[model samples]
Target chain A: MDVIAGLGQGFLVALDPINLLYCFIGVFIGTLVGVLPGIGPVSAMSLLLPVTLSGTPESGIIMMAGIYYGSMYGGSTTAVLVNIPGEAASVVTCIDGHEMAKRGRAGPALGIAALGSFVAGTFSIVALMLVAPALSRVAVAFGPPEYFSLMVLGLSILSFLTQGSMAKALLMAAVGVVIGLIGLDQINAMPRLTFDRLELVDGIGLIPVVMGLFGVAEILTNIEQQIRRDIVQSRIGSLWPSKEDLKASAGPVARGTVLGFLLGILPGGGAVISSFASYAIEKKLSRTPERFGKGAIEGVAGPESANNAAAGGAFIPLMTLGIPPNVVMALLLGAFVIHGLQPGPLMMSQNPQIFWGIVASMYVGNIMLLVLNMPLIGMWVQVLKAPYKILFPLILMFCIVGVFASGNAVFDVFVMIGTGVLGYLMRKFGYEAAPLVLAFVLGPMLENNLRKSLILSEGTFDIFVVRPISLVCLLIAAALLIAPLLPALRKKREKVALDATD
Target chain B: MMLRRAEFWGGLFWLAIGAFVAWQGWLLELGTLREPGSGFVFFWLGLIIVAFATSIAIGGLRGEGPLLGDLWRGARWRNVLLVVLALIAFGFMFERLGFVICSLALLLFLMTVVDPVRPTISIPVSLIAAVGVWYVLEKMLLVQLPKGTWVEDFIPF
Candidate 1:
């Protein structure tokens, strides 16, 4: 009854013309960036972070949220037609989606993808609506130790999931925390790393750092390589799938939705991982696994559904626990912070309008994506035809403009450049930036929680262990940290990474 | 061999950073456990970084990674260098030249020099984008953008 009432109130806010327009703009831009490979949601969100300052918090957050899930819908278009994953989440789609296109089944492939995404996207929103409230109630009981340990676990899970060297990922996480701590110390008024510069007094802005690392660094990396696009020339005959295709897709979509929602709730698990896992699971379950990568509609259906569902599920932590589960959520958290609103246990009660409005907007946005994607497939394909040589410069210009507009300071632009170079180098050296960015956002919170817990416990470390939630979190984190040292587990971790690349 | 290994150099760079951070933490004064100071976390993080850095450097020393040159082998590294230099120049001139002039120059340089899109497309696209963006930001969004501090006195808005 309460849920229905809250949703009723939520729709009242979402249906407002201003919010509706912002939602449309968000999903539209979301799809655009998702269709383009060089820029992802992280870059897009950071680039637009400053723009949010001009609107009501709900409008800004609704737009930011729209971009995320909307990208999940848009990514499959490129993956099916051009054999390039529009975004990282769509990487697996290329294997089967492109094959389906090559076999002159492009229409069915795209049709199923959109259908599966709609089903999954809608399911996840309902689930998020149901799950987030109960979870927030549980989160309300959490103390400083629990919060600290949970953050530690979140960082550990991210580091554990990172490809290549765990050591490098951990080091990056450490560096991120250090960078995050650069400004004024929250506990004490003293600045530890500011070096007496006035700019350092406030610390580095998240927008500049994010744009530098994801936006500028991506352009730098892409321009150094020769990019190729091969759009399918065959006619896309129909937008609806055949009866057989729909029958084949129904199970995978269902399974993918469930699996993605469960995984999405876990910190560090997100769209990319969910999609890959769904593909692997569907392949294992298929009667003829040999057809896994050969125009199988299940292959198209499952992963696409999973990524979209995961995107929705990812919100539970951020909206309830005030912890960003991944880099994209971290950016959303940045948006929330900029708007002077904290998204946590009390948010639903304290800011029910903002909370329910965002939830209601997702429903509206998902429908918008379906309507937009099915009819405008050709438009997205045309967008893909734009040359990279032309695109990169414009992208670079936006990066500069975005960074400058973010802080209105030239120093931030310089910071973006410095981090861009560093990010490019880190990529070459095999370090994942996701863990670093996540940690950078989590660092200050982690420090504050730890200090608060100490003050509460009179400096006894036992406080962390005495608390059941904290103990469990710490133990799990410890196991993940220690797992890489075990040879068998190490091989398993490597296999997962290898599978992702495949 | 260690010097040639990419991991060794990367690890070494982080190691210096770790040491510097630890030194900074120490300088900031580590309060006791009962009343944790600002630097307590920094100090521990620094040590943790140093530990990880040492392990990475040791991995490199054991001859277990790619060579340094292999990172840039057969790559268009010149493009990367040019782009970096261009961005640095943009950063320096952004406020001085203002958004319109600076963005136009950047778009032109990148399209022409860095990757070289034809001037026909480049000039028009550059002009439209720079002016369009400047108008959107300054007028529509009401966000103030620099109008070339050096030329602002001469220009009539």
Candidate 2:
């Protein structure tokens, strides 16, 4: 009843003409970005933030939110067609999606991806409406100890699941924690690593570092080798899937939806990890495992559903607690603050208009994305027509100019250049930089909560165990960390490790 | 095999970087707890990075996997070098020549050098893209861009 009432309020927010306009614009821009390589939703959101801020808080937040989930639908387009993942989450799609493309079944692959995303996205939002408040109620009981324990759990999951050597992920996560500790110490005014620079007083800018590593870096890596694969197959047929395809995909997509939704609620392993996990699970469950990677419709269907479900599932943490589970969520947190709405339990009761409005707008946004992505598939394919020789120089130049324009400071440009170089090398070296970037954003929040928890408990470590919720999070995280070390899990891990290294 | 020297050398290079960052930490004044300082986190994190760097180096030495040769087949050094040099030049010239002129020049250089596209096509496109992007950013977007050397005199916008 409450969910229905809150959704009713959301409709009022979504229908406003100005809000609707921005929602349309957000999904439009999101598709454009999703169509392009190297410009993920995070970069698109951050780049447009300055422009979006000029509007009323609702417009800005709604539009920014639109860009976030809308891109998920758009990302799989390229993954299914040309095998180039439009964003990181869509990477798993290419493994089977492109195989389908190769075997003249491109239509089915894209059809399933589009349909699966739509279903998962809608279901997830409904789940969001139902689950968020319940989680918030549970969250309200948490204190500093619980928050600290929760962060530890988050970091531990990242350390364990991050796609590289365990040691590297741990090291990068630690570095992220350290980087978060930069600027003025929040507890006291003492400078720690400012190096006597005035700019260091505020520490590092989130916008700049994130833009540099992920945005600028991505552009540099991609521009050099912008190969254009033929996305449109010669004999493209019916857009709708066959009954066999649907039946085969139904079970996998259902399993993926459940798995991704569950995993999405967990910090650190949200959308991307869920997408990968879904692929592995679908493969494991397949009757003909040998057919798993070779144009299997379930391959595209399951991961697409999982990732979309994860996108919906991600709202659980952001709405329930003020904490953002990932970088995209972090950007959304900034949007919430911009809108004069704090994202916590208070948000539901205090600014039901804002809270419900954003939720309602997302429904509008999801419909808008589905409507935009399907018929426009032909138009999006034309995006590939923009010659890389022309497109890259312009995009790369924009990156250069964008970094400089943000502050008009030479140092920032230098930082972008350094990150570009670092990012390129990291890509070349087979090291994943996304985990580092994610850790970098989450590190500060974890630190503040950790310190607060410790100070509140007066250094009594038992605070975590005393709280039932925190205890559950800690136990889960601990089990995850230890489980990989057990002989059975280790054997599987070693095989994956060996294959990946080769 | 030593033919995959890039990976072995790359591993060593990262190890050096870990060491350098660790040294930078040592020079800073780590703040105390209750307001634990910035340097404190960096110092410890640097140590942790070095630990991992050492592990990677050991792995490389043990020949744990594929060599750089396998990965380097499609790699293009000319394009890589051109882009890197352009970026470094962009950074140094960003403030002096202004964002428009320096950035456009950088873009033009990249377009000409990296891809096999003709300058007849590339040059005008890059210039138009530069001028067009600058105009939209400054005029429509209301973003205050650098008044570059070329445009700073009369048509600054």
Candidate 3:
């Protein structure tokens, strides 16, 4: 009854003319970024974090959330038409989607992707609505030790899942935490790594770091290589899938949605992993597995659905526990903080309007994306035609402007440049930045909880072990951290990484 | 051989950083575990970083990674160098020359020197983007941007 009533109230907030406008803007820009390479939701969200300040908190958050899921939908367009994944999650789509395009089935390939994404997106939102409330209730009972242990588990899982050496991932996470802790100490108000600089007193701004690492670094990486686009030149005939095509898609869509939602809830799992896993599962399950890379409709249906569902599912931890599971969600957390709102256990009870409004607005945004993607495919193809040479310069300019506007200081701009170069170097050395960014966001909260638990326990480490939740979390983290040491487990991890790369 | 490996140099860079962080933490004073001080987490994290970095360096020492030159073997590295230098120049001149001038100069340089887009597309696009963004941020959003410390008197808005 409470859920229904809250949803009823949420629709009222979401249907507001102004909020509807913001939702449209969000999804529109989201699709644009998703269609373009060298820019993803992380860069887009950080770039617009300051713009969110102009409106009411609900409106801003509604827009930001739209960009994330909308990107999942737009990404497949580029993958299917151009054979280039616009964003990471769409990489699997390029395998069969472009193949279908080459085989003169571009219309049906696109049609199924859109339909599958819509189904999965709607399903995940419904699940998020149901699951987030129950999860928040459980999260309310969590203590400092529990929070600390959970964060450790999150970091450990991320390190374990990252490609290449686990040591590099762990080191990056550690470096992130140290950078995060550079400002004045939260407990005693004593400066640790400030080096007597006033800007350091506030610590590094998330916008600069994110923009530098993601936005600027992306440009640097892309410019170092020649990027080619091979758009399927054949005219797309009809977008509506044939009855047989729809029949083949239904099962994959259903399976992908369920699998994606579950994976999306995991700390280290998201749309990218969900999509890849779904593709592998579909290929394995098919009796005629030989058709997977040869333009199978199931290939187009499954991963597209899974990634969209995962985008929705990734919201669970952030909305309910105030812990962002991925880099994109971390940026969302930054948005919430900038708005003077905290999204956690108390959010549903205290700020029901905001919570429900965001939920309701997603339903509207999903529909908007469907309309935008279907008949307007030509517009996106035109956008794809814009040369990288022209785009990179404009993107670089935006990076500078966005960073400078974020903090209204030149120091922040320099920070973006420095990190941009560092990020470029890290990429060359095969270091993944996801763990580092996630750890940076979690560092302060993790430190605070650890200190609080210690104070509560009178310096005894028993506080962590005695608590059941903390103990379980710590045990899981320990297992993950140790799993890479075993030869068999190490091989499996490498195989998963290789599959992802492939 | 180890010195030519990319991971070896990367690990060594982080190892030095980890040591420096640990030294800084010690200087800041590590409080008791019960009453943890500001540097307590930092000190422990620094040691963890050092340990992890050592393993990575060892992996490199055993020749388990790509050679440093291989990272940029076939790439257009000159474009990257130009972009980086251009960004640094923009940063130095941003406040003194103002947002519009700096942006226009940076965009034009990128399109021209780095990749060489035609003048017809580059000139108008740079002008519109620089002026249009300034209008939106300054006039519509009311966010203040640098209006040239030196050229504020000379430029007419």
Candidate 4:
């Protein structure tokens, strides 16, 4: 009864004329950015963060959340049509989705992807609504030591699961924390790295850093490579999947929803891993495993559903624990801070409107996506054909203007440009920005809790282990840190043997 | 020889930065464990950074990474340089020449010079985007953007 009542109230708020309009705009832009290459949800969200300042918190966050999930729906369009993933999560969709397109089953592929995404998106929201509240209840009991350990666990998981050398990822995270330490120390008023600049005293703005790192950096990288895409030349047969097509996808959709929901709750690589895992699961489960890469409807259905579900699942840690699992969630965390709200356990109790409203709007946004994707698939295909030359300049212009307008400080714009160059170089050197951004946002919180825990126990370091939850978190972090070394050590030994033979 | 590799130089650069941060932290005084000061976290982090950089640099010295030139193998450095310069120029001139003029010029330069698009299309598209964004931010959102010092006196709209 209470949940239903909360949901009812949330729907009322989400359906408000202004909220509805912004939600539409958010999902619409999200879909466009998703369909277009070289522009991702992170860049789009960062570019629009300052603009959201003018609106109510609910509407602003509603739009941002819409962009987050709406992009999931739109990412599949390009993957199915042109074999190009519109976003990272859609990378798995390209394998079999494109094969289906090559077989002239593009329409059915798109339709199944859309339908599966809708089912998974809705499923995840229901799951989030049920699970997040219970998690929050548990999180409410967490002390400073527990929170500190949890943060450690979260960052460890992120660095461990990131697709590169864990050492490099950890190094990036440390660097990010340093960047976050540029302003006045949160505990003491003393400035750590400001160099006595009055501008730096207040701290580096998240907007400028994000705008540079994600927005402008993306443009610089895009400019370096020639933009080329090949669209499917064959006719798209039908918008709806056949009954047998639906029947074939039913099991995959169900399996993917559960698989994705579980994986997405992890700190890093959730969506990518989930989608790939879903594909793998579907293939292993299939009678004809060899048919997977050629043109299996199960492949399209499972990964698409898994990815969408994963996107929804990624929101849980952010909402309940205030720990962002990925960079986009980090930006969203920044948005929450910008609104002067902390996104921890108390958020549900303290800001029920924001919590429930965002949850309810996701439902509305999913319906909107289904409608948009089904009919506007052709339009999205056409939009993908637009030259990158035109889009990059426009994106750059938005970055410049957005950063400048955020604080009416031209200094911030310069900072953005500086960071953008750094971001570009980092990417070129195979360093990921995700860990850096997430760590930067989590840095202050991690330190504050760490100090608080230390103070509580007079710096003995046993408080973390004494607390059951904290002990569990630290154990997990230790495992994550040590887990990758086993395989690496084995490989090194194998290499030594090979060298000896040579 | 290792300096010829991007990873090596990059590692060394970060090492220097880490040392500087650590020195700053030391100057700030690392308090007792029970009552940590503002610099404690940074000091430890800086040390960690130095450790990582050392490994990276050592790895680079063993010729385990790509050459410095490999980073720019197919990159259009001229365009990249021009774009960076344009951005820096825009940042310097943003407050002086105003958002409208500065952005329009930057867009035009990027479109026509850096990558070369047709003048007719680039000019109009740049004009609309620059002006349209300024209008939305200024008029609709009620956010104040810099109107040029010269333009403000001449055009009193």
lDDT of 2 by residue, A176-254 (tens): 6666656776766667667788876766655566667778677666665647676756554566789999999998888
Candidate 2 reaches a DockQ of: 0.46
lDDT per residue for candidate 3 within A368-473, as digits (tens), equals 9999999999999999999999999998888888888888999999999999998999999999889999999999999999999999999999999999999999
Preferred candidate (TM-score higher): 1 or 4: 1
lDDT of 1 by residue, A1-502 (tens): 2789889999999999999999999999999999998889998998898999999999999999999998888899999999999899999999999999999999999989899999999999999999889999999999999999999999999999888999999999999999999989997778779988889888898888888888888888887888988999999879799999999999999999998888888898888889989999999999989998889999999999999999999999999999999999999999999999999999999999999999999999999999999999999989999999999888888888888888899999999999999999998998889988999999999999999999999999999999999999999999999999999999999999999877
Q: What is the TM-score of chain B alone in each candidate?
A: 0.98, 0.73, 0.98, 0.95
**DockQ values per model:** 0.87, 0.46, 0.89, 0.74
lDDT of 2 at A69: 78
Model 2, runs deviating above 4 Å: A223-228, A284-291, A337-342, A494-502, B1-43, B65-74, B149-151
Model 4 lDDT per residue over A366-400, tens place: 99999999998889988988777877888898888
Name model 3 segments beyond 4 Å from true: none
lDDT of each: 0.92, 0.75, 0.92, 0.86
For each prediction, how big is the interface RMSD? 0.8, 3.0, 0.8, 1.1
TM-score of 3: 0.99
Instruction: Name model 4 segments beyond 4 Å from true.
Output: A488-502, B1-3
State which candidate, 3 or 4, has the greater lDDT.
3
Can you write out model 3's per-residue Cα lDDT over B1-157, one digit (the tens) per residue? 8889988888889999999898888888889987988888888898988898888888889997999999999999999999999999999999999999999999999999999999999999999999999999999988889999989999888
Worst ten in a row by lDDT for model 2 chain A: A493-502
For model 3, the TM-score of its B chain against the native B chain is 0.98
Q: Assess the local accuracy of residue A115 in candidate 1 as a C-alpha lDDT between 0 and 100.
A: 90
